[model samples]
Target: MHPETHLALHHTRATDLRAEAAAHRLAAQARRPYAIRTRLGWTLVEVGLRLASPRPAFAH
Candidate 1:
């Protein structure tokens, strides 16, 4: 009886772990496309800021 109970508990824990891993993988997949867009947005903002800022004069 005790061994059966242990087996049941181990199965439950293994299922939970697998579910957690699947959730993480799904979340990462969802984020991957947005990640590239986010990086591109930030790059555009940085370029705009650099273009707007004045350049320093060089001495002869």
Candidate 2:
């Protein structure tokens, strides 16, 4: 009912949300290398396919 109480509640909730976000960010950071590797692997596979495929010959 009091303004101070409402402010405190908001502050506490904000702190909790920030902490939760930090935890998620850390987890994502930990897995970042794996994500990058997966992307790179897919890119390499795509490049390989492109290289292996026959190209259209240009007529003069």
Candidate 3:
């Protein structure tokens, strides 16, 4: 293949890959709130469980 043609093809492929990556990033961003909410809910549940458990006695 000619050098110019190869460079053009490479550029096109790079652009396409960048666009695909951008799309994936956007999709993850869209789900960011849900992910955060899920993590917060789990953390609260953990805290609640800890609070409900009995404490150990300390030795004098």
Candidate 4:
């Protein structure tokens, strides 16, 4: 009886783990990174800022 109960608990836990993993996979696919798009805008802004800012000290 105790062994059967333990197996039942283990089965429930495995199902819970599978559900959690499925949820994570769904979330990952639904909200993916737009690296090229994001990076393009950011890189342009950064370049503009650097061009507009003063240069650091340097010896001749």
lDDT of 2 by residue, 14-60 (tens): 99999999999999999888988999999999999999999999999
TM-score of each: 0.70, 0.76, 0.75, 0.57
Candidates 2 and 4 compared: the better one by TM-score is 2
lDDT of 3 by residue, 1-60 (tens): 999999999999999999999999999999889988999999999999999999999999
- Please provide, for model 1 over 1-60, each residue's C-alpha lDDT reduced to its tens digit, 9 standing for 90 to 100: 699999999999999999999999999998898898999999999999999999999999
lDDT by candidate, in order shown:
0.97, 0.97, 0.98, 0.92
Superior by TM-score: candidate 3 or candidate 4: 3
Candidate 1 has its poorest 10 consecutive residues by lDDT at 27-36
C-alpha lDDT (0 to 100) for residue 12 of candidate 4:
100
Shift of residue 9 alpha carbon in model 4, Å: 1.3
Q: What is the lDDT of residue 26 in candidate 4?
A: 94
